[model samples]
Target: MNPFDYEVDILPLSVEDGGGFTAVAPELPGCRSDGDTPQEALDNIYDAIGCWIEAAQEMGRPVPQPRRAAA
Candidate 1:
C-alpha cells in the first residue's frame, strides 16, 4: 500500500516556527515534514511515512493503518 493513502494534515507555520508549511500524518506518530511550499511539504511527508512504516516493520512494531474516509 502507498503511504500517500494515509491522511495528512498540512498547516502553515508562523514566523517563529520558521515560516514553512508543515505536513503531518496523525496516524503515524512523529511522521511529519516541513517545506517552503505545501506541495513540497506533502512530497517530503510521503517519504517520511514510508520510512516510518519501514522502521516500524524492522523493529517488529505495529504500524497503524490509515483512517477510514468520511462518507
Candidate 2:
C-alpha cells in the first residue's frame, strides 16, 4: 500500500509547544510526527506511515485501507 494514499492531518504548534507543525495519520492510530514546517511535517509523517505499515505487517496485524474521497 502506498503511504501517500493515506490522509494526513497537519496542525500548527504554538510557541510554547516549540512552534513547529505536527502531522498525523488518523486512519492509522498512534502514527504521527512533527517538524519545523508543514511541508517538513508531511515529509516526516509519510516516512512514519511506511514504518507503521511495515511494523504492522511484521507483527501479522491487519493494515487498514485508506479511505478515498468521493468523485
Candidate 3:
C-alpha cells in the first residue's frame, strides 16, 4: 500500500477563544480547528486537514503540497 507521507503544518497560536486556543494552517486558509487544550487542537487539526483536502478536490482545485526544507 502507498503511504500518506505528505506534510501539513499546524500552528498553535496564543489567541484565546471561548475556553481554549486555536490551531490553523497558514498555507491552507479556512483550514482551522480548535480544541479545549493544545493536544486536542493538534488532533483536531489533522481532521481539519483531511476535510480541507477533500473540499479542495471536490472543487476541482489542486491542493498545494506542503513545502519541505532540503537537508
Q: Against the true structure, whose lDDT is highest? A: 2
RMSD of 1: 2.0
Best by TM-score: 2
- Per-residue lDDT of 34 in model 3: 81
Per-residue CA lDDT of model 3 for 12-34, tens digit only, reads: 45555366757776667777778
True-structure RMSD, every candidate:
2.0, 1.8, 4.2
TM-score of each: 0.91, 0.94, 0.71
Q: Which ten residues in a row have the lowest lDDT in candidate 2?
A: 62-71
Local accuracy by lDDT, each model: 0.91, 0.96, 0.65
Between candidates 2 and 3, the one scoring higher on TM-score is 2
1-71: candidate 1 lDDT, tens digit per residue: 47978999999999998998999999999999999999999999999999999999999999987876533
Look at candidate 1 and tell me the lDDT of residue 62: 97
* Residue 65 in model 3: lDDT: 69
The TM-score measured for candidate 1 stands at 0.91
Q: Model 3 — which ten-residue stretch has the worst lDDT?
A: 1-10
Clashing pairs in 3: none
